[model samples]
Target chain A: MAGLEDLYREIILDHYRSPRNRGELPTPPAQRVEGFNPLCGDEVVLFVDLHDGTVADIKVSGQGCSISQSSGSMMTAAVKGKSVAEARALIRRFKGLMSIHEQALGGEADQLDEDGADGAGADDPDVKLGDLEALQGVVKFPVRIKCATLSWNTLTQALDEAPA
Target chain B: MTAVEAGRKAATPLDVARVQADFPILARRVHGQRLVYLDSAASSQKPRAVLDAMARFYETSNANIHRGTYQLAVESTEAYEAARRAVARFVGAPDPRGLVFTKNVTEAINLVAASWGGANLKAGDAVVLTEVEHHANLVPWLMLKDKLGIELRFVPMGEDYTLDLTHLDRLLDGAKLMAFTAMSNVLGTLTPIRRITDAAHAAGALVLVDGAQLVPHVPTDIAALDVDFFGFTGHKMCGPTGIGAMWARPELLEAMPPFLGGGEMIRDVRLDGFTTAEVPTKFEAGTMPFAEAVGLHAAVEYLGALGMDAVREHEVSLTAYALRALKERHGDDITIYGPSEPAMRGGALSFTYKGIHPHDVSQVLDQKGICVRAGHHCAKPLLRRLGVGATTRASFYVYNDESDVDALVEGLSDADDLFSL
Candidate 1:
């Protein structure tokens, strides 16, 4: 249970039980992207409303374990009403948090490899994670790292699809 | 002896403590706790005997089977063939010559679909399957459907998680083949194979039984069941990986084309074209799984000594205990998805605990050293039908005992406590 405590922090479970910005947005007004952890069937559907270089509204709707769903909820809370550039920076920083320990262990985090070396910036002082920092515990359990990052990756894809 | 007599002979209960000692892995500690492995439906842990047999094969008779005339090669070939005979006998196949060694059950099913189905089936021909089938049983037929335009029909699962055969004849109508599982990997539903085979035969259809989950758990007599083809894997039967088998009828094996084209399967290789080898060799194209066959032979011998009936009896009792314990402890909080009758199902108990996601439940359980499988269990369509994205499955085998089930019940409480809203 000592290891379990690190993986499921109190803040993380709160987000899972009561996910923030949870629902679907109409596709025409919002760009949607879905990320799947095929190993566990954990899915994350992101709907981002990017207007005038700002994420005017964002919602996450999917089903997954506490780590994935809570990470998604915390992500929506952090990125909503933020600039597109700010959101992308948060995504990189969050992924950095998830992949830092994985890189140290020399684990095969193929998903993290495509981010172009942003994983080393986990401790970047410029980026403040706020509630999103709760998910930093997920790196301890390597398999759940993908669950923690599923929403961030989907958010990245959603932002790419949205009008800049 | 008859199947019923075999069942009577299995009245001698197995010594579970002695059985656990045979598998070395069960003794190891995980997270400072004893390992309570309940995922045998996914893949079983091998015993010391199986391991020793494989090592012995490599040490003594490590050579290319059926290729060299050297002493080692001759011994290797004999050992491999003997393994095939033992595995075939375990399933009650009349002739060992009909058994073809495959990589795993997936490859075995694929071999049948590509070889037998390819040679016989045409566009619009229906291949009836069941809703409870694993992806191994489903994907191959789906691939054939995509390639040859063959129609696929499914026998629906009843509310009790058993196969609904109310319209079996209707689904098997005009069907060229009937493929289904003997026991579901996820639900542990023991299908009425003889009934299904009879219906399929009456409707002039050949039957293929996916025994990946069944052959390892119960008394399986392919001759008694009278199915055209049977596919199973070695890993699920306390044997090593990289080895499985497909047992087909002699006429069907003789008629079907070779699955993989390479050395060891040709009768005569000419400048222009080549003639195929005989029945079993015709399908076994490349190098045989020599060491794995030896391992499988030892595995079957081990299981034979334990007696499959005793194995089934142990599982049924353990499953009954688990079912009662899980429900009694958790009540409405735990929803186990399978047949309530232990006699009706295998040891796989797929469940959703306290509305918590299966991955979370499994993660919490893993900390307690309980190895349970979470997620779709490779039966996505079946999970969709059950209206759940995933489930935490705790399957029992000969190595598992009442204490393992108790650990699982206690671990679920721990998960419930951690996720209590």
Candidate 2:
């Protein structure tokens, strides 16, 4: 029996109960992006605002199973008020951590020929993905990894397509 | 042997002792009590017979089929072909040549969509599919539509979850193909296949029936129904996993090009080009799952011995009892989707408790050792039409009886009590 404590840690439940950046920002400046976990029918709409070169605001709203919803809530809290470059670095680090291929993050940074030259690597050095490290346990359960990464993936999409 | 003799000779109707013995998993306690499996629609419990068939094949005659001349190779090829024959007979197809084995029903539909559909359907051609189709059927055609510029149309369902065939005739105009489910996995409505097929044929359209939900419970005759294509999975029909069959008319299969090109599906390879093999062999690309095929054959024989008619009767009666019992217990608080008449539906039932989320319901049911699927159930469009994000589904199978239904009712009551709504 997988303990509820192991699968649904206290931090996860807390995020689900009282999500951070849980509502939509105003229009004109923010872009709305929707992501779905087709496996468990988890959906999240992320509203991201870009001010100059920084992510000025981010809000997430959706309905899903606890893992997905909490992951979304945590994602918003983690990336809010960061610069675009910093947010991208955080996403890469988070993905690498979730996929259990930490080396791939280093490989991806090297492969980004354009970004590689600009010291994007040095600017956002491989900082330990703190609370997000909890999701590293999801790799053992292949099916649940999607639940953990759905919001992060959505965040990436919102950031990529965000109006410059 | 006559159907009556077959029924008499078959094993008892999945009694507690028989069920416990056949499914090794049932002996284990999940959340404390014995596991009450009600998610057969997702996948069925494997019997010892099917399991042993695979093991026996692998232990003795494991070889790549149809390529080698050795004794083991010959035996493996024979076993695989015998499984094809069993599948053909199981679905009442005239020739085994018409059946093509794939990984599962999803791959089967994709084979048709990519090969036959891609070849024949043109820019203005329309594909008529039902709203209740699983993503397996829906996505493949959508992919074809995007690639080939074909129009994808949907046949609407009534509030009762039955297909609205009155508008089907109108929608059939300029339709090239009609793909639909014989029974919905979620709502459990049994679509009128005969009428739908006949009307589609009259409209000069090909019909493909998704029989993943239908083949397990009911006796199906492809020739009698006059459907052009039928797809079903092995695991759902008491067979081993990783095998499924698609039955097409021999002529239609001959007309269509091969779905996949590889070792088995080739006849002669030259430096310039290669020639394709026969009807079924042309469709089977790589090395087939020989052991899985043998297990599927054993599964078909097992179902035949039990008799599909009796199985259907047992399920219909059980579904009726379940509907009545759940409705009695929950009253107006429960919203059961699909037809009220069990005879008009299959064994699955998707429902929503007024105040409870389906995930919460499923979690509570899990505590009671009752396993039911909770989600959109791979039918997002249909769920959206039903105005719900998700629902909890409890599906029944041959092993299920009245007691299982009682357990489900008890579990739901427990859920309601815990939620206090």
Candidate 3:
């Protein structure tokens, strides 16, 4: 049986307990979107502030299970202050990490290893997933995948509808 | 004893052991312990009779009805129509033609909302529903309101969880339809259906009763209650899943348009237009669940043999015993919802332990080989009204005995210890 340690990773729990940038952003230059998982009553509201074609700020407020809340917390922290292009790239990378295809990246594993402990090497040939790689464990539990991706999906929607 | 003497004698109580024998699944073990099922309100355990009926249908008489032209077709048609008669008789409908088979009660309610509600309700037309309605009953009407620009109203429940008729009267004005549950699945409050229906009819509004919880536990005669429409499911009444019935007045069904259009529901097809079939068949589109209908028919026979009055009595006794036992054992440690009078409720109890979440209680019960349901139970609005996020519900059926109730109380006590504040 997979223990709570795998599910409630210390970093995830820390983020859930004290989520970063948790609030609403003003609507003038920011776009807001809501996401809901009907199965377990998890809901998330994502607000994005765009400044000069970059994500100046990202904030989230919601009530949900620990996995969803922590995932939202991690998402906001990962994309904050990044350019629109960078944020979109991070989303794609996060999707790749959560996808079942990650196991096929074996040949590129050594290149990823040289990216340093933070997993932030842009020069590495391998996919450097950064902090979002921690969510790979969620795929084992099929039901929790929705919880982990709900906020990211909401953020995608918010960014899509955001004024250019 | 003479036959008259035997007939006059008081009926024997429901034999839990004998009843348990009819259910094949009950003989098995779950989690290395004997299964103690206490979640019948969620969905009932199917019996051998229902299973065999379904299997027999598939084995012998497997053909499309109302569209085929062979010996197997005739037999299949007979069996399917017989099941419709069985359901109609079981619910005391005046005619079998009034019963429309759907996937389940949820779909039945949706059919009425889409068909009858769409044709009748207009902009500013009001719909009065109770706070205790299942999402099946609530959402369809809300969808109708959103589509038609109608106003929706709610009848509030008292602190005891019973519908307040005084408030209902006030909300009835300008209401074109009143939809409610005969018995709440979560709270187990048996709303006074006859009174509410009569009042709605007097106000010139039609009433739809969601009988998913009530039909399994008690005998329902649509003629006696004079309800405009009643919805019930098969799986909740010891039948196979994927089949249910909606009983509406013949005229009401005749007046409503077909919900889903397809082969069975059409009289003739043309490139230009097609005429619809009669009531019942008009609503049942596509290839029907013939085997499931047979299973539901057998379930009706099983309940009839047991006698609904006896079943209701047994539930009353069990619920009363449970209420007293839980109250005596826990007192301030628990908060029981719904009517305190057992006779006023159905075969379930919804309660909250003072300091434990329902999920925690369910886990403790699961350890003891007892299965109960925890969560909002698909009635989020009612749960919100009760001022709780969720509840621990233990529902009873014919197979349940006092021992099951004792086990539940013991499990809760254990949960209290394990999850102390």
Candidate 4:
């Protein structure tokens, strides 16, 4: 039996208990994007403020399971002061982390390989993940992979809608 | 003895261990633990008899039904109609000719909405519904309201999680139809179908009962209930998927147009026009699931041998046990949603634990091989009404026993330990 400790790490529980950057940002200065897992009715609402090629501020407010809310919390903390390009790279790296075991599970590895590689051919493999690496265990449970990536998907949408 | 007294006297409890043995999957282990399946409301595990009947149909009498004059085809047709007859008798319908087989309950309800509602209803017609309906019952009427400029009114739920009938008279006033569920899939709230049908008939309206959750768990008598239409699926009652039934009054079935046009549903077809078939065949369009029908026949026979009254009695006692056990073990940390009385509801128990998200709770329980559904349960409107995103639902069936409930309760403590913070 696969242990629950693999999925629910202590750090993940801590993040779930006290989510970081958990609130709403004003709509006028912040671009908002919402992501929903229709399978489970989990929602992730993101508000992003971009200025001078940097993510000036970001906040997450939504209701979901522990993996989703904790992932959103970690995502806001990671991208709060980073450049947009850096955040996009981190998104690629984080998605790579989530999909690694999914590929091993005989899923659509080819399509994910294509999606993971940007024009740069690699997502800067040396990128530091910090606490985000804890979510890599979510790949063991494939259904929950979406829960972990929901916030990042919403972040991608927010970046697309945010003014450059 | 009167029928009620006889029924009560004959409500012998089921031998759950033997019943569990009839389902092969219950013996299988999940995650190195006993598989405690509590998600029967979504779909049930098929017994050995149902599985064998379906295989036997394909092996012995596999042929397209209704048209062929050959030996195998005739046998196939007989078996299919016999299944229909068995299901009709099971639900207390007077005639099998009024029952039409569709893919599932959702399709069954859609047939009524599109075929009957489309032909009979016009703009400004009102359809009264209740707040406790699954999306299968609610969305069809909503689609009709959009297409035909009709009005839809809902009977709200009281604080007790049952429908508040205080305004039912006003809601049914001048309505063209009243469509609702006999049992709620989310909260396990059983509606008073006979009373509501009486009111609808008195108000000069038709009634359609969504029996997807009701017929599987309790005794259903469509004729006694006096409803115009009754829809339910086979998979939730220990039968295979891809087969469901809709029973309607003969006159309504005769008056309604065919839902899907195809080979079996037509009497004759020409380039200019075509004539529809008789009542039941008029609605059945394609080469239907004959094997699934065989499975359903065996399933109903299995239930009949066990007796639905006994099944209902067993669930009532089991639900009462679960309700009390959960409350006693968890105390205020748990919030179960539904009517408190087991007789008023079925075995579905939707709850929240220690303010933890339902998904997380279900994930932890999964480690212990406990299968419970954790989601909006296709009742988003009702969940929104309750102001919760989702709930963890543990529903019981004929095969489940108190041991499964014990596993679930023990598994919750595991969840609490990990996510208590």
Cα-based TM-score, every candidate: 0.97, 0.84, 0.80, 0.97
Which of 1 and 3 is the better model by TM-score?
1
What candidate 1 gets wrong by more than 4 Å, as runs, is A100-113, A117-123, B1-3, B6-10
True contacts kept of each: 0.82, 0.29, 0.00, 0.93
Give one digit per residue, the lDDT tens place, for model 1 in B1-421. 9998766675778899999999999989999999999999989999999999999889888999998899999999999989999999999998888999999999999999998889998899999999988999999999999999999999999998999999999999999999999999888899999999999999999999999999999989999999999999999999999999999998889878889998989999989998999989998888878899999999999999998889988999999999999999999999989999999999999999989999999999999899999999899999999998899999999999999999999999999899989
Query: Which segments of candidate 4 are over 4 A away from where they belong?
Result: A100-123
In terms of lDDT, the best-performing candidate is 4
Q: For each prediction, how big is the interface RMSD?
A: 1.9, 3.4, 4.9, 0.9
Writing each residue's lDDT as its tens digit, candidate 3 over B34-89 gives 78899999999988999988888889998988878899999998999999999999
Expressed as tens digits, the lDDT of each residue in B1-421 for candidate 2 is: 9886576446355344564477667778886887889999999998788888888998999999998999999999999998999889999987789999999999999999998998899898999999999999999999988899999889998877898887888899879899999999889999889999999999999999999999998888888888999999999998988999899988888889888888888889999999889888899989888888999998998888777877887888899999999999989989999899988999999999855668767877876789999999999999999988889999988778788899999888876765542
Model 4, B1-421: lDDT tens digits are 9998686666767888889989999889989989999999999999999999998889999999998999999999999999999999999997788899989999999999999899989999999998888999989989998999889999999999999999888899999999999999999999999999999999999999999999998988888899999999999999899999999988889989999999899989999999999989999998999989999999999999888988898999999999999999999988999999998999999998988999999999998999999999999999999899999999999999999999999999999999997
User: Which of the predicted structures, 1 or 2, would earn the higher lDDT when compared with the native?
Assistant: 1
Candidate 2 vs candidate 4: the DockQ winner is: 4
Q: Rank by lDDT, descending?
A: 4, 1, 2, 3
Error of 1 at B356 (Å): 0.9
**Pairs in clash, predicted candidate 3:** none
Cα deviation in Å at residue B379, candidate 2? 1.8
Model 3 reproduces a share of the real contacts of 0.00
What is candidate 3's CA lDDT for residue B356? 61
Candidate 4 residue B133 Cα shift, in angstroms, is 1.1
